[model samples]
Target chain A: MALKVYADRMSQPSRAVLIFCKVNGIDFEEILVDISKNQQFSPEYKAINPMHQVPAIVDGRFKLFESHAILIYICCAFPGVASHWYPSDLIKRAKIHSVLDWHHLNLRRGSAGIVANILMANIDGHRSYPQVVNQAEGILLKSLSKLENFWLKDGRFLVGGSQPSIADISLVCEIMELELLSEKDHDRILSPFKKVVQWIEDTKIATSPHFDEVHGILFKAQKRFRERMKTQSNLKAKL
Target chain B: MALKVYADRMSQPSRAVLIFCKVNGIDFEEILVDISKNQQFSPEYKAINPMHQVPAIVDGRFKLFESHAILIYICCAFPGVASHWYPSDLIKRAKIHSVLDWHHLNLRRGSAGIVANILMANIDGHRSYPQVVNQAEGILLKSLSKLENFWLKDGRFLVGGSQPSIADISLVCEIMELELLSEKDHDRILSPFKKVVQWIEDTKIATSPHFDEVHGILFKAQKRFRERMKTQSNLKAKL
Candidate 1:
């Protein structure tokens, strides 16, 4: 039986995992657990991932969650998946792990939470509180600066390597979530980090069609979010 | 030359790394990077770890940070270190990684940050806002319940395992930081999760002297914290 990959393309990590599988030609089946509709909270999905978060995977009798873990597993377990994604070299692999570990509380925290906050605020027809938004933005900008000045300082990818590791894919997918923000907000946030911008582009070019294809849901959502915001503003102006 | 470990015993992850090294009998030099004194931000430490975090390792010319990454490296690179700590079995290791990755945003965020908030509030001589504390406590309690109900339900350690992996040490160390909280608050937060409590004890027994030795700083700090809280309470009563 093929591996079952439980995911929502709208999720950054889910998209990362999906893109990875595609890029490597790993045989798998994608099972969508839509978060926007609270499908992840259903009992059936909870059985697959007690945490009810994606992306998770079920292979034979084994089950796993957390995208980094899934990514590492895909790298280690699958044949013909390529070694550069998560090399066997101890030092190189450890450095890649460093980026993955650092990413959880740093990049993922700031980027993912802020996008959700903006969307929730839009849906609720009110701006997210300035203090909360600003605090998250502070973390996001600091993380971006670190990526620009330190992680990307030496090489083309994070952890100073020529090839994109799982770290690059994970971290880039996180940055890509910023695209969900308003054009001005996105530009204002990303403009300061020239190197980070270039790195994101580089990761996209490296992964190509798969990367863009997996992220298609996000683009559609972005359009819908903007439309809703415009309609809400028009209604307010009439009042 | 032995491996160099930059750490602060007061930091949970730092203690986890120290204890792991001692238990594994890894030859290492302990270098204190006092976070409380802002020593982590020093030029020297920054050279070793640009992220300016504790629990960084310098193995000859190679340097690495993030405790989970460092643990994975030690497991792979060192010859004598046992495999149970991070098994080579692809499935087992991935599950452990799942716990470790899930930890950062869930258990660590809730447990570690609350302790810091309590300490800072005490040192600055005021209470953390009730709303903020409650929110964090909610996250912490929910995370503990998840550990009790799911992760520890089947095995003596996390991920339904008989042996303690890096995930166990890293996570148990996080819960141990609750020792720094007042007895009332600590018990209030952890008492409900019977299995989690037992797992913490099991982990302590599994790692024994090394665990206790590394945690000595936290015990002393806990005493000082309680005394300080008592003094503050007495002063407020008089006022």
Candidate 2:
């Protein structure tokens, strides 16, 4: 049986896992669990992942969730996966793990917080809180600075590696969510970190069409959000 | 050269790494980074782990941080580490990875939040805010309940494995931080999760003397906190 991938493309980690499989030519079926509709809460999907989160996998009878875990599994288990993604050298792999672990509360939190604030504001028809946005931006900047100053100091990828690792794919997908922000807001946030921006471009190029393909939903959401803001501003002017 | 573990016992993940080393008999030096005194921020420690977090390891020239990453490195690189701690089998290792990843934002966050609140209240000499305490408690209980209903549903350790894995050590260490709470508060938060409690005891037995030895500081702090609370209540009675 082909590996089963449960995902929602709008999710950052979900997109990372999907793109990884595509880039590696791993055989998998994508099963969408729509988060906007709260479909993940349904009993059936919960059985596959009791945590009710995305980017879970079912390879034959084996079940797993957590995108980093899934990515590591794919890199280790799948035959054709290049070692650069998650190298066999114990030291290199350990460094990659450090980046992934650091990412959870740092980069992931910052990007997800900003996007979530945008989402909640849009849904409730309220202006997003300035303080909350500022806090998220602060975290995002610190994370980006760390990448620029330290991780990206030596090599094109994180942890000073010559090639993009799973860390690159996972983190790039997270920064991609900034697409949901207004163009000005996005630029203000990301423009300061030149290396981070270049690295994102590098990861996207390496993964090519798959990176863009998995991100289609996020792009649509970004476009829709911009349109909605414009319509709201026009209505206010008429009033 | 012996593996150098730069850590503070007061930190849960720090204790996790220490216990794992002791349990597996991994030879190393424990260079204490006293977090209470802000030693983690010192230039020396930052050079070791720019993230400035406890539980970093320097094995020969290779330096790494993030407790889960450190644990994984130790398991893979060190000889004679029992396979069950981090098995060579791809699938089982993947499942363990899932648990470790789930822990960061869930169990670790909840436990750390509650402990932080206690520290703030004690340091500021003010009664802890009820709502903040309630929020942390809610997160902590939900985490423990998940363990009971899902992860602990099958075996002696997490992920349904009989022997304790790195997941077991990492998580059990997080739960142990609740010892910082008042005896009443600690029991109130933890008592309902019977399976989680038993598992904590099981992990303690498996790791033996090192587990308690490393946690010696936490136990002392727990005792002092309890006495401080008793004195505060007694002084209130005079009114």
Candidate 3:
């Protein structure tokens, strides 16, 4: 039996796993766990991940959670699939892991959380806390500055050297937040780093065969981001 | 030439790397990054890890940081040295990574940070905002409860499986806080879980080739711990 991936396309980690499966030719059932509706908390889904979180999977009898772990497992399962995705160079691989380790706090909880909370404020009408948003912005900017100044300067990709690594998968997940928060009108936020924008664009294609389908929801998010970006570019302009 | 490790035993992550190296018969220089006085901020060390954390390594021309990442690098560097240190089974390894990922937020920054802060509190007569300690406590107890439910039942190791994977390394680092905070008498806060104790014993012997050194430190910590544990155990034994 093929593996089963419990995911929601709207979830960045889920998309990363999906992209990993598609790129590596690892066939698996994509079981949707709707985050918008809180489907992950369903008793049935909790059985898959007792923690009630997504980007979980079950291959054969083995159930697993945590996006990076799942991605690594899928890569290992695919015997000859690309080693570039994880890399065999111990130092390079460690760099990838270091970035991933740093992400749980910096990007996942900080940047992406801020972007998501901003959107949630709009969607849920909860009074927003200025300090939280400010803290998130500070953390996000600080993390981005570190990544840019330290790792991304001359490296071909973040931690992947010339090609994207699993680190790219994690980065793509966090950068997907840009889709929700990217106001073209307010490009001042991420504007100085055209290189980063290009990298994000490249990460999108790296993770998928069909960019349109894989990034469909993000495209929708980008579409509605007119509040930030006045005119949505029709020419597939690099985000 | 052997790899070079920049660390101070006072840092839990540093100790994790040291214990792992000792256990695996690896030869590496111990370049102490004295953290007690905030020596990690020196320009020399900050260049290695802009985050300026310890437990980093310089292997030939390559540099790697983060204790868990360093552990993987060591395993890959010395593949034949140990097997179960980081298991081969997909599910087993994933559990280890899940715990490691969960560690920075749950254990490392949570309980371990509390331990460090409480250590400073003893000398300086200052406490972190109670909310921070209280929040960390909540996270730790919840995590400990989850661990107790998962690992104690398996009766084997820390990650609820047959062997001690890198998860044990991460947990060992957190538990090392018990030694660090012995003056604060926090072991009993976690003493409810026997597997934690047993697992610590198992890992010390398994990964620590120098059991005498490991026990020596623990013995000293216990000496100081016992003196404080007499009556104050009831006051803050729960931490």
Model 1 chain A: lowest-lDDT 10 consecutive positions = A123-132
- Report the lDDT tens digits of candidate 3 across residue range A1-239: 98899998887888888887877778778898888899999999988887777889998888888888887777777796788888767677788888888787776767665776676665445777777888887788777776777768767588745678888877767766666764651366677767777787787666655444776887776666544343434323656
- By summed lDDT, which 10 consecutive residues of candidate 3 chain B come out lowest? B225-234
Error of 1 at B202 (Å): 1.5
Q: Which tens-of-lDDT digit does each residue in B1-239 have in candidate 2?
A: 99999999989999999999999999999999999899999999989988878989999999999999999999999987999899888877998988999999899888888888886786458677777767877888889999988889889898676789999989999999999878888898889889999999999998998889999999998898888878877887987
Chain A TM-scores of all predicted models: 0.95, 0.96, 0.88
Q: Which stretches of model 2 miss by more than 4 angstroms?
A: A236-239, B126-129
Candidate 1, A195-232: lDDT as tens digits = 99999998999999999899998899889888888888
- Where's the lowest-lDDT run of ten residues in candidate 2 chain B? B119-128
Query: Can you list each candidate's DockQ?
Result: 0.93, 0.88, 0.54
Off by over 4 Å in 3: A120-123, A182-186, A208-212, A219-239, B116-128, B159-163, B178-188, B205-239
Alpha-carbon lDDT of model 2: 0.90
Q: Which stretches of candidate 1 lie over 4 Å from their true place?
A: A233-239
Candidate 1 lDDT (Cα, 0 to 1): 0.90
Superposition error at B87 for model 3 (Å):
3.1
Give iRMSD, candidate 1.
0.6
In the order shown, what is each candidate's alpha-carbon RMSD?
Answer: 1.5, 1.6, 5.7
Docking class of 2: high
Candidate 1 per-residue lDDT over residues B1-239, each given as its tens digit: 89999999999999999999999999999999999899999999989998889989999999999999999899898999888899889988998999999999899988877887888787666767767777777889889988999988778988666779999999999999999888998898888888888899999999999999999998998999899988988898999
